[model samples]
Target: MKKNIPIFRTGDTIEVQVWVSEGSKRRIQLFEGIVISKRNRNFNFSFCVRKISNGDAIERVFHINSYNIGNVVIKKRGDVRKSKLYYLRNRIGKSAKIKELLTKK
Candidate 1:
């Protein structure tokens, strides 16, 4: 049996380094974005990340325990409503942004 570890949550901005394989080449790709939602728990866990690219909003879902994921670095925290930020899709520009929370280290 595999033991699950709690590592991330919604509203956290994280930089994820993922390993990608293309034929005989392997490389690490970096993705930085805010976690908008988390679903299930333990081995079935998954989360969605939202980022703006080329003046367009982009969202991606990643598994918690996938081999492609190399590391996750939390960059900032956000104040939000509900567990999922699906409403953000309808928002644009400044209205779509999440408020940053200052944390005491």
Candidate 2:
């Protein structure tokens, strides 16, 4: 992982800015979602993000140390009881919501 990226837990919401290349042009694209899980590898680290778009659930995996990733911003920390939120895949509507964790500044 790159330096100074905030330590995020499984249930936290994050926005990742990624670089996209089209022809000879490059632009930054944002991917915001709730973290589903984090994976540790010998030399690679990755995380899974889930979001609901147009009433459809979408999940994407991102490599933490990739050059394509420009920034990772934390939006919210959830008060969750599970280490892995795979159960959230089956939830819909109000049941899919995660309670936000209160923090002291």
Candidate 3:
């Protein structure tokens, strides 16, 4: 059975909880970042997330249908014009921030 993953798009700020295993022990790891890109290939669909930690940029690509993914929580919607936010890589500090898209809920 496929896990219920929320519908998300590039530029959205999201937190992904992943199941990590170390030998006989297992734990949930939280990865919070901005979605930079998405690849739609039917069952091979995947997405890339980027985040800054300790002054270094870290990016992780996760398969949407992977069982290791515990949950995906959308924090904020970004008002970006591009489908792939690759340009954000060159930015630093405040310049790298994406505008939040307001929605009537």
Candidate 4:
């Protein structure tokens, strides 16, 4: 399999566009969220995204090399120490926020 992965760390905000099939027609759907964790293991590489919808926390995992995914755009990088952000699951409101990492040019 060809490698075409984006360089995004856990805790970053990203948007994933995926192809959705509805009946005979197919369309691209956008799923935007913060990266909670990344399961990197060669071909089975996948990432989990978390977002608050309708006042409820929603999480979705997507495969890195899946054909169904159209795009994965990173919006912001975060300053975090852990590889898995499972602790964010317990956070709510303002407490669930992750600090943004600033890179100097």
Query: Which candidate number has the best lDDT?
Result: 3
- What's the CA RMSD for each of the models? 2.4, 1.4, 1.2, 1.4
The numbered model that scores best in TM-score is: 3
Candidate 4 segments exceeding 4 Å error: 2-4
lDDT of 4 by residue, 31-73 (tens): 9899999998966788999999888999999987788998888
Q: After superposition, how far is residue 71 of candidate 3 from its true place, in Å?
A: 0.9
Question: Which runs in model 2 stand beyond 4 Å of their true positions?
Answer: none
Q: Show how many residue pairs clash in every candidate, following the order shown.
A: 0, 0, 0, 0
> CA lDDT of each candidate?
0.82, 0.91, 0.92, 0.89
Alpha carbon lDDT at 46, candidate 2: 90
Which lDDT tens digits does candidate 2 get at residues 17-93?
99999999999999899998988786578999999999999999999889999999999999998878999999999
Model 1 ranges with Cα > 4 A deviation: 1-6
Q: Candidates' TM-scores?
A: 0.85, 0.91, 0.94, 0.92
Q: Which ten residues in a row are the worst by lDDT in model 4?
A: 1-10
Clashing pairs in 2: none
lDDT of 3: 0.92
lDDT of 3 by residue, 23-99 (tens): 99999999999999999987668999999999999999999778898889999999899999999999999999999
Supply the global lDDT for candidate 2.
Answer: 0.91
Model 3 misplacement above 4 A = 1-3
Models ranked on lDDT:
3, 2, 4, 1
TM-score of decoy 3:
0.94
